[model samples]
Target: MFKIKKQISKLYMASILGNLSLTGAWVAILAARGYSLVEIGIAETVFHIFSLTFEIPSGVFADVFGRKQMLVVSSIMRVIGSICMICSKNLTMVCAAIACFAVSYNFSSGSGDALAYDSLKLVGEEARYERYAANQLILYRLCNGISTLCAGFALFVGYKIAYASDVLVTCIQIGVLLSLREIRLDHTGTDRKQEVLQSVWKELRVCFVESLRFLKKAKRAVFLMICNSFVGAVDIVLLFFLQAKLPQTGMPDSALGSSLFIMEMGGILGAKLILWCKNLRYRWVFAVTSVLVLCGVLIEHTGIAVLMTLGGFVAACSDDALQVRTDAILQEMFPSEQRATLISMESFTFSVIMIALSPLAGIVFSVW
Candidate 1:
């Protein structure tokens, strides 16, 4: 029980480090380094491409190998990526950095939640999964808020410093991760190598088949996943270009951090509010919040900083709400045996959507 608590703490801390990037200043910094809006979009495309390629394989590997070890590898990859992002001055370097970032993200995608859920199950606390997931989301957004709040000041000092902070945080996350124990629910009592190998193969095959079966039969789950993925794509695109868009809205570059901080705060609040919204239908929550997101994006160029910031806040809040609700639905829909793989499918779909839309987003932003 104590160990489970410790793992939960480490997961929360690592989640904070993971989400806490340079916030709104990354685009500005990249632009200052001579990257056009299109170039920035291409870099992001590179990210999703790598993610789309490795996302499911990594998840399968986690279910077969071990989640804790994969998480360690993820931290190492993120550290390398952050270093690259900090040192890079050109598009090629940024693409390399984003590639590493994508690998890191793909590796860790569904593993964390799977680990947490399995840990709770081992301790007879499986019922706490939704609450735990929600709390994790809140903590993740809280870190985003902290990162954004400091990003402008970091930029005031130097872009290198802002980017370097991500490296430092990831390093700390690695240290926390090292303390986590691997929880294998399907641990075999026998130490026979051949039998273990066969068992792993069988589990992998079952995981794949079950995932497909779920997709074919679960229409509600598919629809929810589509809505979640769409909102996620829009949120990510807006976040990537928002720093660039601020200038067009008559906002100074220096205000980027504060603007991002406001959005993060909204996300944090929305995540926290999900506790009260458990009774609400997921579709209704999605429909209402998605409309707000659409409106926010439509009016993003209204040339009012306050209005733009408010729109950003609304969009961020909606994304968080949709994410938390959709995740809960997925958790309930998938069996524990196929949890990681199914969640990874959702992530893979989102990545593919993002990859397809990235270049178009770049073109739109560049033309605008």
Candidate 2:
């Protein structure tokens, strides 16, 4: 594990806080709104729909139009969705809200990594990627816990309050982006494009072609992406499992909030701890992911909210470490220019698979 440069560490905090504020209120808000288990599943479906629909184009835009540009646009979309949530509670309103939020989310997903990577490249310190990875994980954890704590207080007052807070957070993130130097991480800027948003067929062809072209160019990168995706999928399993079992405990809100907060706290600790790790002889991520899924199974088959919470902690620790290691490996393997495209391709594929399976996974957990 390496140390993140001071500048990267500072901006990372803002990014983490912005993300946590968005995610923290979301699950609790939907649950409080009387969305049934199935309806919640459908909402998740809508989220993925937004992801699936936007992933490739957003990736291209992040590459070509500039990450900061996409990020600012994403911030505005998030603020709009938060406002929608504040004003309405009807099914149509909720669906509209999900659509808006999902677009913001999908739009911003890989762009953050793209921006961070570019910043490192421009500073001629791309070798320090592992440090950035670890710091990012820790900040994400710290913000998650804080957001949930904030959410509990907000919800005690009202869920709308929590949504409004998210709006404020996004506004702050926009300012943070403006503070950073413009980054063209890759030597050749990715933003050159000749036409309007391409047709679905054109987009599909570009995503696959660009992905495959990069794959042939960097074999080691393909391996890292495969490993990252496999490990990341296990996370989806645990997430949907929570969607099922939290409702079963009859203390759904508190259970989800407490467990999520604890789990994220573990992530904060684990990420910091990674900087202290002295060796790379361990496959810790695989170990932790296995435990997380096992805990999900046990929590579902038995009445073990305590174990579920513990599982969340274990899962978080593993994921944080896994991501740092993956970044270190991939950064070393890929040329700077293609790194963003490859990562976006991997994420787009992962989201596609998760969307197809997440609903079925939720349904199975609910029945069992």
Candidate 3:
């Protein structure tokens, strides 16, 4: 059991605020809106665009303006987007809401951690990265559990209550943002703002060139990113299962939350387990995924809810472990020149596949 440390201060708390609030309502809120597979697919498409377009830019923004400032802006955008989502009942409003949310996330995505990592490096705590990273995962899982559990309760109260809960979390995110300690980049009283226009152009150019270089050189690593994406896309198929079961069970929101809760909990165990793996890049993920796919097929064929749930657990653990391992590997190998863009592209490709697969999943579950 990793005890929460005294050194793990407000910065860690502040860093995760955005993800904590955003993760909770993201899936449940979409389901509540009654958007179909196609609509959800479109929303995911926008997410990919925002994520891809902003990935490198946001990191550059951090490099330029400092990470803490960008996070505040990110939280603000998320609040606005959530409000947009709450107001709209149709797919268009949902789409618009997604667009705003994507924009917000794009601006804030990779930068927060980059800022933290740099801070750690400055302090010569680079070796502790894995431990702290694992702790963050634990906190994420615990927070995710609480948030989704709250969403489940809110569903019993009403869908509006759930939406309201999201708004409140955004408020939490805002407060967390204000409390963050600001660190100046490179110990320079001379600010990145001095070279704003030049840095902007340089950033754009470097992002493009470096992203290409990473993709070209890191073939095996890139393969893992692809697998991560495709597996994630397939994971969304379980949503159709939840959606179809909801009306019949006489409560939809709670069912959706409970379904997600299972996966999140499974992810908790899977995340910490990554540190124990000796040869994750060479063996574990491929072996785990192959076996898990068999479980997926069985879950589908038998239509046993328990088996399906277990399948989700297996999938979540395997996927989460594989992703963390892959991300750690990439971070270790890639230089700052193109790290964000390469990571973004990997995520973008996955989101694209997820977008396409959502509809196919809808078709399959509809028939089943």
Top lDDT prediction, candidate number: 1
Higher-lDDT candidate of 1 and 3: 1
Model 2: per-residue Cα lDDT over 76-108, one tens digit each: 888998898888767678777887887887667
lDDT for 295 (candidate 1): 74
TM-score of decoy 2: 0.83
Q: What are the lDDT figures for the candidates, one per model? A: 0.78, 0.66, 0.60
Candidate closer to the true structure by lDDT (higher is better), 2 or 3: 2
Give residue 357's lDDT in candidate 2 (0 to 100): 66
Q: Candidate 1 at residue 95, lDDT?
A: 94
Highest TM-score: give the candidate number: 1
Tell me the alpha-carbon RMSD of every candidate. 3.0, 4.7, 4.5
Model 3 whole-model lDDT (C-alpha atoms): 0.60
Q: Give residue 211's error in model 2 in angstroms.
A: 4.1
**Which residue pairs come into collision in candidate 1?**
none
Q: Give all TM-scores, in the order shown.
A: 0.91, 0.83, 0.81
Where does candidate 3 stray beyond 4 Å? 1-8, 19-34, 178-199, 236-259, 279-281, 297-301
